[model samples]
Structure formats: structure tokens, C-alpha cells
Target: MKIAASLRAGVMATAVVALATFQPTPVAAQQASPQQTVRVGIHGADIGSLDPHMSAQTIDNVIHAWIYGGLVRFPAGTIDPTRIEPDIAESWTKSPDGLVWTFVLRPGVKFHGGYGEVTADDVVHSLKRAGDPKTSTFASDFASFDKVEAVDPRTVRITLKTPVPSLLGLVTAQRGGYVVSRKADQEAAGQYTAKAIGTGPFQLEEYRSKQFVALVANPDYFRGRPKVDRVVYRFIPANESRDLAFRAGELDLFYGRKEQRWVDRMKATPGLAIEVFGPGELRLINLNTSMKPFDDIRVRRAVAHAINRADFVKFVGADVVSPNPSVVPLGYLGYTDQVERFAYDPEKSKQLLKEAGHPNGITIKVLGSNRSFVEPYQLLQAQLAKAGITMELQLVEHTAWHAQIRQNLSAMVVYTAARFPVADIFLTQFFHSASAPGKPTAVTNFSHCDVADREIDAARIEQDPKRQLELWHAAQQKIVANVCAVPLFDEDQVWGRSTKLEFGHKLEASISFGPMLTEQTVLK
Candidate 1:
């Protein structure tokens, strides 16, 4: 919760080693042990929150996916809109007008830790909780909802303010869609945020803060018994330490570095299988339009033109990285690259800065995380320098970056995230005026841009697909021309595991943005 006072040495995060913190002195490999437990390493100092609705960060969401269930869900090990299957809901129906939906809960579904059976009441409560801005970080995603009610003991109904692009997407297992036990939440009071209770195949056994979490398999899990007996999820904040732990066989699977050199090195290690999968998180550089130099469009354009996206794509390696040309992530429904983009032109950058009344390049400060973004920012700082711009970085630890950015503490922000593969979801959260920082409905609109507010609002409810696409395109064009943010790269996640582990399903894409561990995940 607090940023450590000391600064880490300037090096790639994957090169900073702390052997004593992660490696075991001497022990048998976990894969060969009799426990059938898989030990996984996480990239955080500690979990930010366990409350499913509030788990907006990648690591916490990894834990949430194992603990919670949704009414509808993307298939295990993949994120695809067409293949959504039932989780808590056994059957569902929608009204003719598409404004109302009803679902029948699967019988005998029980919450973790003796919370008793999941009911329509629990579903209603969970959905409503997700919609409450005070309780959820993704409240804006549920803006279309009108009401939710328990139709009966097993049936629940949801009424929407208007027809959304995809009703099932909202209720599927991601972000605000994850359901929690109403009884458990009420009984636990404030304790529910720190410890989760759900009906997934795994249940929390113990949580030693700043260390690790032990989760035992749910014996009565609805899908079937979990193949693995237990999961030991450990927090290894440093990439180098986490990698050393994995290489030493202290961990069965760990998050991998998404650089070409690292992936190539890991591939050479016998028995290690590296997986690079999606949703490709778009790493963007947001220029704070509400602040001083950034308020001028020429300055914003100058800032954007100074850096080259190709340099980043090459640095990260073409295999692990996907180039993104627009503000919206590639493959989203309304994605387009027809909009204007400021290309990498150093001379043009200086000219624009001069027109904006700054002959000498202006300096901007960014608060970035040492663990997640130090290398990228360093490369960017050098790139900007060529065009007479100076980017000063105030480096902090990983968790602090998430906390500080929300408080609007940085003039520029280098943020990376994989959201629901929908244009409206990404646009509304990062581009909509309502989500601007310091506002009542603040999400992560770090740019404070309002150039295309009318277009964004109109597109979300346009109903006609063709017309909606037009509106969405117009919005992107406006935002690009205004230079609110520079689209960098679509970063596919990297993870390494022992080949002896079989994850039951094919690794393709995961809405969780990490490898999806399911009931069938097993040790071969």
C-alpha cells in the first residue's frame, strides 16, 4: 500500500535478482511431489483487492477467476464472444424487445466455505452490487441496467434501460460479471473484501499477506472434482526473482517476461513450455489534456510524433507483441485504423512545439512502476529527447502506480490493460468525459479528453450496427486528431509452465488476461 522510499537500480526488471527471497535452499521439485499441487508465481507485492467486482488489476483478477463464477462465461482457457456457455445459469431467455432477461440457476450450486446454496437472491444481489459505483470499479460497464430481481427461488430477471450490444457479455465471467454469495458477503461484513467466497472449483484456505495464498480444491464443485489437489499462489514482485524461482523448480508456473530475449532463453530450458496469449493488452501513453502544455493540441501532437511505435514493437519482439494502430484495441467490434495518427517525426515534433510557443522542448513528469514499466519508459524518455522533449519519471513500486494514477497525480501515464473485447467498454472508460479523473464517476480517463463525448454516447445506444460503426469511427478520428493519447503496442501476455502440466483446453485467449486455470487443469 505504500511506495518504498528507495529506488531500484536502472535495469530491465527481469535482470534484477534476489535469490534468497524466492528460491528454495534445497527441496524436491513441486511437480514431482505427491501433493498434486501447482505453485504459481504472481507479479505483485500483494493483492490489491479480492472483492471480485473491485479486482481491476491483473494479478487480483487471476485470483478472482479461480474463486468466482458468472451467470454466463467465456469458455475455459479462451475468450470468444460466440462460444459463451453457462456457469451459474443453467438456462436463460430474453424478452422480444431485448430489454429484459431471465435466468434459471443451476440446482445445488453452493458457495465456498459453507456459505450454503447459491440462489436467485444471490445472483440479484451480486449483479446489483456490480452496478453500484461505490462497491465496484467497473460500475460504468453496467450503466444500461435498470433493475434485477429474484423471480423465484431459482429464477432471476434483469431489466435494462435499453438494449445493449451484447447482453451476455455483461453477465459473462469477467470484470463486473463475476457473482458472489449474498449471504457470505452480508455475514462477513467488511471482511469480504480481503477474503473471497465463491462457488468456483477453488476455495481460499489461508492468506498470509505479502507472502502467498493457499487454495484447496472444492470437493463439491459443480463441474466435477478439480484434477489438482491444491494451488499455492505466491507473490514474487520482482521478475528476476520470480524467474529464478521457476528455473530452480520452486514454482510450477510463473508469469513470463514478454521480451524476445527472455522468451528465447526460456524456450531453451528443457521441460519449460512458454505460452504467449491474449487479450493483447494495449499499452498507451496518455497525455493529460486538462494540464498545462498538454491542453494545447499542437503540444499533444508534438509529444506523440516524437516517439516511434516500431521501436517498441522491435524491442518487445515481433512474436510476443502485436502492433496496435488505433486508440481502440485491435479485434474489438468497432475497431478501425482509418483515423489520423501522428507518425514518428522528430523535426515535425520540434516545429509543432515552436508553434505552441515552446521553442525549447517542454518537460513532463510521469509516475511509473518499476516492476511493470521501467524499461519501456526509459526507451520512451530517450525517444522523446530527440524531439526536444524531456520526460522525467518518478519511479514507484507496482501497486503504488495503480493507486497514485487514480488520484490524478501524474501529468502523463503509461498504462497497460486488456479489457472486455468491446469498443464501447474501452471507449466509455478511457475516453468518455464521465470517467475523467477527479470526477464523480472516475474510472481511468487519465487524458481528461472531451473532444468526442457526443459521438461516444450516441454510438453506444445507436442500435443500428452500420450507423453505430460510423459513430464509433468518427469518435476515434476526433480523439486521434486531438491527440489525447498515443497508441503504442498490443502486448500479448507471456507465461511459462512445465510441459508436464496439462491445462485441459487449448490456450488461445483469456478474458482474465492470464492463463485460465480450470477444474480440469492437471499435473501429468
Candidate 2:
């Protein structure tokens, strides 16, 4: 159901009644032990898609990670790809020329639904599917791949157009890396988004539109069966409603609120543990330069100077959120002091506005989602108003907001994202003109800044790691100079879990969605 953004209060009241009536599944009761099921509450109203290759949103990637396996994977509960280990691929070897990579598949890894053991052919098909633009929004992530060939029943070789130092890291990431079963994809065909069968420890059991998604442990999983017999992700869009369900014991874990007061409140709640870690999401405001008004750099810079970062950081706790110094956030490489060039000066803002022929200031309409984006934008609206600029917000459902932004409808776009690890990934996806909206292979270039396109393209194939970073930093500086987008802050990833729950690895940080549920995650 599409809940109106303005109807959150009404929905919260009805949601409580509905949640109170929610019964524990039979699978939980059937288990002899208490550690049978884990129910989680998240902020999204629904999953956009579950197909491993198709789903690019963090909400969807979180679910996909559980049901899919990649050739190589980041260590459990971690985000850095440098520490990656073998998954479906037992091991791999690189050619002396550094252009060819050969991977050896694990002998007995089996796909769900009796599709039988995963083979080299499946790997070839999966990579090819990921590279196909029509099938995956992140197909560009694999643009370096020239060919993927199955050398034998157990070996697959991937040839690259150029040696990408971050190739392994890219292949181990959630987007283009996760392997999907060829047999399952073929069987599902038009129904792939709803159905998924992979080599992971959990199998998709049931998916209820706009409500919840249920998964059951895979008994024949290669590593071992998941300790929890069932996992249920309930879609609770309202922050207050999610907190309510979590406090009432309907949810064992839930996504935490970003506001300072809410975090403190949850921290005081007994029997609850809050985990906040980063290099997290970089929350940014993308001013549509392709459209009128924002098309002018002076207007874009005016919008930037009118806002107060100190107020924003203070509002959302300074402990949890930090100032983003560049388009490339703090924790990532290639981040520089380029952001210092734009300071929070309302006087400068008005001057720029005057010079641009808007002495009385201008009003811009912005579209955003209610869950997380709206709160920040509302604060921004108030901040901008102080500088004589008006920010008019039109709120919509999260999914609809995403659809609208991609169509370039909003004058100003509010987005928070955990980008791909490498600097090139962020530059190409967000700054390259080829990936901008309205382009043939557009993905997330919401700002439509094309000046850095040449540098971003050059950085993608730069072999020297240090020089690659330098190029990435230069490209970012260009974006900053153009005032294409305002880098607000990078907030820590926060989640509240029951003290009784244990995810085998340390939940210190993750680049994926949340602390992932591997075969070892279990309820105490």
C-alpha cells in the first residue's frame, strides 16, 4: 500500500493495532529451542526488487546478500574489500600479464531448489548477466570485463579490457558481484524479481508485498545451515512505529533513528544495544543543474552558502554524524579539503543571489521521501529560509520519490548513500556525464555534472593506486567548484538489536546494508 507522506501519524496509529495482532509464525513454535526465529523491523515501506542483479538500493541489497553468494566476499560483518576471502570460488590465480583472472569453483556448493552443484558455466552466465545493461542497473560496474569464459567444469576465466586494481574489490561487492543461479534465473524468467534461488545459507520462503519478506534456513548449504530457522523482515516505514514494535518485543532488532534525542532514548531502553559505525552514508543535496535556475552556478552556490552545517550536525547528534569535507566522504580515499571552499555564509548567499538577478531570494521546489530524507530536508528548508531563500518540499512515498528523482523532476534532491568502495566507483556513478540522468546508461548521476567526465573516465583505468586517487580527488574538486551538489554530512550507520542476539562476526561496520546474517547468526 502507498502510504501518503503526510499521513504518517494516522498510519502509525493503525500500524500499532496491526502489529499488536501479528502472531508468531508456526515455524518458531515448532522449534524445540528458543533460538528459532528472528524478526527485524526496517524503515522501508517495501523491497524494490529482490533479484540480485536488479536491486541497487541498500534496502534490497541487504535482503539479497542473504540469498546470494559471490565468487569472493568481504569478511562477514565488514565492508572493506582488501580483507576479502573465497566464497563460491575456492581460490583464484592471475595471469602474468595481469589481464586474465581464473577462478576455481568450490566442488560441492549447491543452488537452492535442487538445481544441483554450482559450476563454471553458472559463474560465466551470472557475470554475463551482470554486465548486460538491460538486466542490471549496475552493469557499468563491470565495464572493465572484456570476456568471462568457463575454461572447464570447475574453472572460469575473466579477461579485462584493462587491469583494474580494484577488480577483486568490485567483484566482492554486493552490486555486480553476487552470483545468481543460472537455472533459477531461467526458470523464473519474468518472475525473477519475486523468486530467488542461490547458494547462500537462506532460501526465500515468502514475500508479501508492502508488508514483510520471510526466509527459511537452507539445510543443505555448503558452509552449514543458518542457526536461526526463520528470518522475517517486517517493513515498518515510520521511525516511531518501528521503535514501538521493537520496544513491545514484536521485533528483535530495528533500524535506529538518526535524530540525537531518539538515539539517546533508545540507548536508555533496557535490554537493547545500539551499534553505530562508519564510514557510513554521505547525505547530500543534489541540485539539478540540467534544470532552470539551478543551471546557473551562482544559484547553486547560493543554495550551498545559505545552509548551516553546524546546525545540521548539532540537530542530528555530532557524535553520530560528521561534516563531509568533499563529495568523496571522509572515510574514503581521495577525500580532500575542497569542501572548505564553500562556507556557511548567509551574507555571501544573498550577494550571490543578488548578482544572479534574484535580490529578494528565490523559492525552489524539492521532492523527497518521508522516512529519512524528509526530516533533513525540512531542517534545510528552515535553514535556507533564514537566508531569504525558500525551500518548498513535496513529500512522497520512498519508492515514488526514487522514481521521480531519476526522472529529474526535483529542483533539489536529498539523498543518502553508501557508495561503492573505490574512489573511481563514486566518481563514475555520480559525476560522469555518461551516467547522468537522461543518458542511455544512466544510474545515479542526479546532479548531471559533466565537467569532470574526462578526469573520471581517466581515473577508472589508472593503474597506480596513489595517482588514481589523485585523479579522483581532482574530479571531485571540479564538482565542488561547479557547486553541483552540497555535501551535508556523513552519518554513522546505527541499528538497535536485542542483547540476546549474536551475529557470528563483530558488527563493527559494514558497507552493505546492516550487520549481515550469515550461517552463524543466531538468537541466544
The TM-score leader among the candidates is 1
RMSD of each: 6.2, 5.7
Find the candidate with the highest lDDT and give its number: 1
List, residue by residue over 1-524, the lDDT tens digit for candidate 2: 00001101111101111221244553333333333677788878888788888877767877888888889987886666567789999999998666899999989999887889999999899899988988877788888899999999999999999877567866674777878788888888757866687888888888888888888889889999888887788888788898887666667678877667777777666567777765467788888998888988999888888878888888898657888757776656566665446778888999998999999999888888866655667789888987778888889977788888888899888888777566777767777787788777677847588888877877777767788777888898888888878888887777777766678877656666676888899776
Those runs of model 2 whose alpha carbons end farther than 4 Å from true positions after fitting are: 1-35, 96-98, 338-340
The superposed Cα distance between candidate 1 and the true structure at residue 406, in angstroms, equals: 2.2
lDDT of 1 by residue, 1-524 (tens): 01101111221211111222233533433223456777789888787788888768888888888888999899886676778899999999988777899999999889888888999999999999999988887887888899999989999999999887767888898778988988778877857855588889998887778888778889889998798877878999888998887666667678888788888776666567778877788888888888888989999999889989999999888877888778888777788889886789999999999999999889988899887867878899999999999988899977678789888888898888777777877887888898888787778847587888999888877878899999888888888888888889888878877776677888777788677778899876
C-alpha lDDT of candidate 2 relative to the true structure: 0.77
In order, the Cα lDDT scores of the candidates are 0.81, 0.77
TM-score for each candidate, following the candidate numbering:
0.92, 0.91
